[model samples]
Every structure is written in C-alpha cells, then in structure tokens.
Target: MTQQIRRVLVRSFEDIVIERVPAPVAQDDELLVRTTVVGVCGSDTHAAAGHHPFIDLPYRPGHEAVGVVVATGRGVGDFAPGDRVIVEPNLYCGRCPQCRSGRYNICQELKVFGCQTPGALADLFTIPARRVHRVPDGMTDLQAVLVEPLATPVHAVAKAGDLTGRTVAVLGAGPIGLLTVVAARHAGAARIAVTELLESKRARALRLGADVALPAGAPDLVDRAHEALGGPVDVVFDCVARGQSMAQATDMVAKGGHIVVVGVGAAGTTPVRLDLVQDREIRIEGTLMYTAEDYRTAMSLIASGAVDTAELVTATFPLEDAAMAFSASLDLEQVKVLVTADGAVGVDGR
Candidate 1:
C-alpha cells in the first residue's frame, strides 16, 4: 500500500490549498526528509499573490526548511536516519560554465527546488543528499529555519566586497533587508542605514543593528539617508528592487560604489538615470540564490549567536493550516511566518 502526505499548493492569487498526495521514497543519492518546519518566504507570498517574476502558480511552496532524515539512498554516507538537516534548495547543472567557476547559483540550467520544482511543503519529501546540510547539535529549529534565507543575504553582502569601516544603505526592512543589516554588521560595515514603509519594521531594523532607520516613503529619504550616514554610502543593498528604491539607491550611493540588487521585483522595465550611471561609474550587480559556502557561513553565524532568529519569526501554523500561514506572512507587520508538520514543535513554541 502506498503512503500519503499533505502538500501546500498555490493555485492563484491569494488562493492556497492543501492536498493529499502519494509520499515519495529516497532514490539513488537522495534522502527522504520528514519536514519539521518550513518558512513562508516573501517570494512565496509574492507568488501566491501573482507578483513573483519567476515562480508560477499551482506549485508547492517551501524552500527554507528544517527537517529530520528518515531514510538515505544508495551511495549516501554522510547522513543517516534521525539526522537533523536544512535544505539548500538551489538545483543547478554541474556542467554549466557558472557551476564550473563555483557560481552555481546562476547556472545556465538553474532550477530552485521550491520555486521551480516540487519542494518540501509536504509531510515527507525526497531530495538529493548533496542539497542537504547537517544542522549543528546546539542549533534550535528556529535558528536552522533561517539558515537558507540568511544565506541569500550573506551571498549578497559578499558581492559588496570589503565593507570594513564603510557606510551602507539597505532599501527595505522586511526579512531579507533586516538580515542584510545583520550580514553587513557581521562584515564590519562601519555604519548601516535602512528604509522601510512601516514604522515598526524600521524599529526592528534598528534593533537588528542598523545605525539609522528612516521611512522609505519620505520625500527626502535620499537626503536623510546621506545625512544619517554622514555622507554618500559606499554601498547600497537594494532589498526592495522597485523603481523608487532603485532611484533612492542611485541618489544615495557614493561615486563608483556598488548597488547590489537583492530583491525580486515584478516583471517589467524600470527606469534608471543613465546619465548618472555613466558619470558616476556606479556598478549594479544582480544576485541570485547562494552556494554551499554561503550556507555554511550562515549556519555558523546562527550557531554563534550572531543572528536573532527568534525575533524574525513572528508566527507559526500546523501543516494543515499552511494557507493560514501564508495569509499571516502577507501582513505588513509580520516579518517571518512558518508552518510545522504534525507532531513537530518549534523552539519556544512559536
């Protein structure tokens, strides 16, 4: 007899449903994981609302997840049943030039496990062993759940080069933007400023180590950000990636500085000041998901008490209530929302 599992699917705008499906088994070089916690990401919300540029509707919705291995497939030796692990989610072709150069995050044939393919939003899911990372013994589920999400910002900040004693601006204060504040602080940025439309998110950014937090809707946001940083910022991490935030970043960055686009914006052309780009020599770089190195760095940061995971995750729901979890994630005040499998419990019961 075949076993069954429950999976979450987004069928249309603000329409998510849980369906029962046949469970999968561990195949060659794969592991069958019993998901404990799955984070509802901003992308997941966007996709549900029909805004994400990449992810299509009618798909499973999970990428940042923590689970326990129940079975291991042929040739897998590093992990065994009962081992706690986190999913890396990025699926890439090894033969691509980007992969050959160790930048598989943007491989020519890249397909994310959760976004582009079926993911771990079910009671049990099978994934290649190589895409799973073992969680340290002391790390709590809350901390482990953040490993995948934090890795993205970790990779983005690395694109900014050396930040020691350098001023930085983050154009949003949602989960990714706040984590950028944490990553920049860890990278030794002398000062950091954040802009968000919500006053509560701005306060949260300050608590997360931003030196300055301003309203993103302010007409003089660029001026206020510069004044707060004492001058033009050396780098601007555009976590919003919208036309307004991009304009603000271009106006706030110092000449020759870097603008790392970290967020996923809606599909369409956004205007830019070409004259300023030509005169200032500003470098704009796009970053995608992360490699294993970033995952390791993020896990280490979590284990060492560098990231405050508890504060970021605002709510949780059982697997049967996955749709509710997504609804909670859409609230502007909520930072991170998670879903738990039956019999699974998150740290602090959050």
Candidate 2:
C-alpha cells in the first residue's frame, strides 16, 4: 500500500485545492522532508493566478519552506531523520554551460522545485540531500522558512559590488525590498531609502532600518531620495520591477552607479531607456534566484539575528487554508503569509 499525504495544488487560475497524493519516496541521495512551515511568495500568488510565465497550471506552489528529515534514501550520509532543515529550491544540471562557469543559478536547463516541478507544500516531500541545509539549533521553523526568500536579497546585494559607505535606494517595500534594506545596512551602507505604494509598508521600511521611506507615486520621489542620500544613490535596487519602477531606477541611480533588477514584473517585460544607460554609463544588472553561497550567507545572517525574519511574517494559516493564505498574501498591507502543516512546530504555539 502506498502512503498518502495532503498537498496544495493549483488547479486553475485563482483556484486552489488540498488534495491527498501519494507520499514521494526519497531516491538514493535524497531525503524525505515532512513539511513544517511554507511561506507564500509573490511568485506563488502570481503562479496561482496564471501570471507566472514559467509555471504551468495544476502545480504545487511552494519553495520557501522548512521541514524535518523523516527519512534518508540509500547513499545519503550528511543528513539523518529528525534534523530540521531549510530547502534550497533551485535544481540545476551541473553539466550546463552556466553551471560549469560557476553560474548555476542561470543554468541552461535550470528547474526550480516549486515552479517547474513538484514542491514542498505537501506533508511529505522528497528532495536531493544536497538541496537541504540543516537549520541551526534554537531557530524556530517560522524563522527557518524565511531563509529561502532572504537569500534572494543576499544575492541581489552581493551583485551590487562593494557597498561600504555607499548610499542605496530600494524601490518597493515588499518582503524582498524590505529585506534588501536590511542587507544594505548589513553591508555598511551609509544611507538607505525605500519607495513604497502602501503607507504601512513605508512605516515597516523605516522600522527595518531605511533612512527614508517615500511613496512610489510621489512626483519628486527620485529627487527626494537623492536629497535624503546626500546625493544620487550609489546603487538603486528595483524590487518592484514594474516598468515605471525600472524607469525610476534609471533616473534615481547616480551616474556610473549600478541598478539591480530584483523583482519580476507582472507583464514580464519592461521598456527601458537605453539612451540613459549609454549616456551615463550606468551598469544595469539582472538577478535571479539565489546561489548556494547566498543560501549559506542568509542562514548565517538569520542565525546571528542580523535579519529579522519573524517580523516579516504577518499571518499564518494551516495547510487546509492555503487558499485563504494565498488570498491574504494579495493584500498589500501583509508582508509574508505562511501555511503550516498539522502539528507543525513554531516559535509560538503550534
């Protein structure tokens, strides 16, 4: 008899259901993880609404996750049952050109666990042992769930080169944007500013160490950010990724400074002004999912209490209420939404 487990499935646009599926068996060099907490990412919401270009319908949609190792397959040596771990969702083909060049995040045949394949939103899921990292002792499952998303900003900030004493601006106060502010501060930035559409998120930006928080639609947003930073910011991270925000980043960044595109726009395309980039010699870079090094750095930052993952979580629901959790994530006021499995352990009461 096959073991069964409950999992969340995206049946269609705006339609989600909890279905009982066969428990996945760990292959050699893999581990079976019993899901604890799974954070609902913006991409998950997009995928649910049929907005994500890469994700297809009738899929399991979760990547940011923390779970316990319940079983290890043959040949697995590093991890054992009962070890708490965070999942690094990227699955890359080691032989790809990009992977061979040390850029596996952009592998020629990269497949993300949640987007392109099965994910960990289920009660029991199997992933390669190399993709699972042990969570530090004393860390709650809630905090461990954040390590995956936080690794994104860790990668984005690192892409901006040395940030010490430089002024930075992050456009958007969503989870990734707000976390960018924290990463900038951690990198010894002299000043950090965040532009957000929601007032509550602007306040949260300040609380997260932003020196200035301005509304996204402010007529003088670029000017105000420059003034706050004592001049044009050395780097502008466009976390919103909308065409308007992308245009705003080009305008806000200092001449010869860098602009990092961190967010994925709803339309999946942006009309950028090449003249500005050419004339100013501004460096525009695009970042995707985090690398293994970024994951390690993110875990260390979380372990050291440098990044506050708990504050980012605004609400939680049981796996049965995943649809409700996805709906809650649509609210701009909410930062991060999580779905918990039955009997899942957390910092607070389960």
Candidate 3:
C-alpha cells in the first residue's frame, strides 16, 4: 500500500483543502522530518495567491521551518529518529559558477523547497541530511525555525564587511528589515535607525533595538536620519524591495557608505543610480540568499541571545488555515505569521 500523508494546501487558487499526499521515499543521505512549525512568509502570500514566478497551481507554501527527524535514509549518520532541526530549504546546483565560488544561493539553477518542490505545510518532509541543523542549546524548535530568514540579514551584514562603531540605516520595517536591525546591532553598529511607512511596524522596529524608527520618504529624511545618528550613516540596508525606496536610500547614505539590497525587486526594473554610485564612490550591491556560513552565524547569534527570532513572530494559525494565514500576512496582520503543522500549539506557546 502506498503511504499517505495529509497536507494543508489549495487544490486550486481558490480551493483550500487538506490533501492526502503520497509519502515520499527518501534517498540515501536524506532525512524525513515530521513537520513541526513552518513560518508563513510574505512572499508565500504572493506564491499562495498565484503571483510568484516559481509556484503554480496548488502547492504547500512554507520554507522556514523546524521539525523532528522521523526517519533517516541509508548513509544518514548525522541524524536519526527524534532529533530536532531547522530546515535550510535551499537546493543549489553546486557545479554552477556561483556555487563553486561560494555564492550558491545565486546559482542560476537554484531550487527552493517551497518555491520549487514540496514544502513544510505537510505532515512530513524529506531533505538532504546536510540541510538539517541541530537546534542549539537552550533554543526551542520555535526559535530555531527562524534561522532561514535571520540568516538572510546575516549574509547582508556580512557583505557590509565591518559595522564596528558605524552608523547603519535600514529602510523598511518588514520581516527582513526588522531582522536586519538585530543583525546590524549584533554585528557592532554603534547606532541603527530604520524607516517604514507603517506606524505599527516602525514601533516594532524600535522595540527591536533600532535607535529610531520613522517614515521613509520624509522631505528631510536624510538630514533627520543623520541627526538621529549624530552624523551621516556609514551603511544602509534596503529591505523595502521597491524602486522608490532604493532611489531615496541612495542619497540617505553618506558619500562612502555602503548600501546593500537584500530584497528582490520587480523584473526588468533596475533600481540603481549608476552615476551617483560611481562618482560618489557610494557602494551599492545586490544580495541574494544566505550562504552556509551565514546559517552558521545565525545559529551562533541565536545561541548567544543576540538576535531575537521569537520576537519577530507576530501571528500564528493552523496548517489547514493556511489560506487565511496568508491572507492575514498580505494584509500585514503581523511582522511574521506562521502556519503551524501542529494545530495544538497555542498562539504564544512553545
């Protein structure tokens, strides 16, 4: 008899339902993890609503998750039944030029689990053994599950070189922005300020250690930010993923300041001001997904109590309520909304 597993998914764009999916047989060096918690991302809202490029009709939409190993394939020695882990979710083709150079997340042939394959909204998931990371000491699965997104900002901060005693400004107080603030602080920025239009998000950004949080496009935004920083900032992290914010931020940064764009932008639209970037020696670079080292750094930060992944989670719901959960995310219901595979977990329960 073919094994079956239940998955909370949409049969069609509008048909949300629980599906009896065929249980996947793991290959050697893979581990089958019984799903625990999966964080619903804002991009998941686009993919779930049929707007993402990689997703098509009817799919499970979770990428950041933590679970317990239920089974191990042949040759899988690092994990066995009952080991808790965080999922890396990225599957990069290692032979690509980007991969060989240690920038695998940009491999032209990259395939993300939720975007290109089965995701974490189901009863179980099979992933390469190396992609499963042990939950660090004293960190619960709930906190460990956020390693993916946290690592994103970690990689961006890495690209910024050194932040010791430098002023950093993060544009946008979304999930990535909020997380970036934490990482920037932990990376040694003397003062960090964030900009956002949403009042609630701005407030949350402040609570997360931002020296100040304010609206992004104010007439004197640059001057105001400098005043808040006690002078011009040395780095700007743009998580807004929009052309306007990018354009505005270019000038907000100091002459030699570095600006890193971690958010993906609309296709065919370039957000850079080439002349200014070159003439002023202002460095602006595009950052893709995190590297393996980025993940390691994220784990260390979590273990050291530097970044607060738990505080970033603002809402939760059952897996079967994925559609509603995604809708809530699209409506900005919270900083981060997670669709939990285990329904018995209360809103704030560990």
Winning model by lDDT: 1
- What would the TM-scores of all predictions be? 0.97, 0.96, 0.92
lDDT of 3 by residue, 1-350 (tens): 56677676755446767767677667899998888888877567666666665667677666898888888899987687888888887888889898899888888898888777878788788898877688887887667877888999999999999899999999998888998998999999999999988888888888888999978868888889989998767999989768888887787788888889887665566657888888879988889778778989989887787666556887888777776776677766377888777523222212
Tens digit per residue, CA lDDT, model 1, 87-124: 99989899989999999999999898888888888888
lDDT of each: 0.89, 0.88, 0.81
Q: Which candidate wins on TM-score?
A: 1
| Residue pairs whose backbone atoms clash in candidate 1 | none
Please rank every candidate by TM-score, starting with the best: 1, 2, 3
Candidate 2 TM-score over all chains jointly:
0.96
RMSD of each: 3.6, 3.5, 4.0
Q: Count the backbone clashes (under 3 Å) in each candidate.
A: 0, 0, 0
Error of 3 at 21 (Å): 1.1
Off by over 4 Å in 3: 10-15, 53-58, 343-350
Q: Output the better candidate (1/3) by TM-score.
A: 1
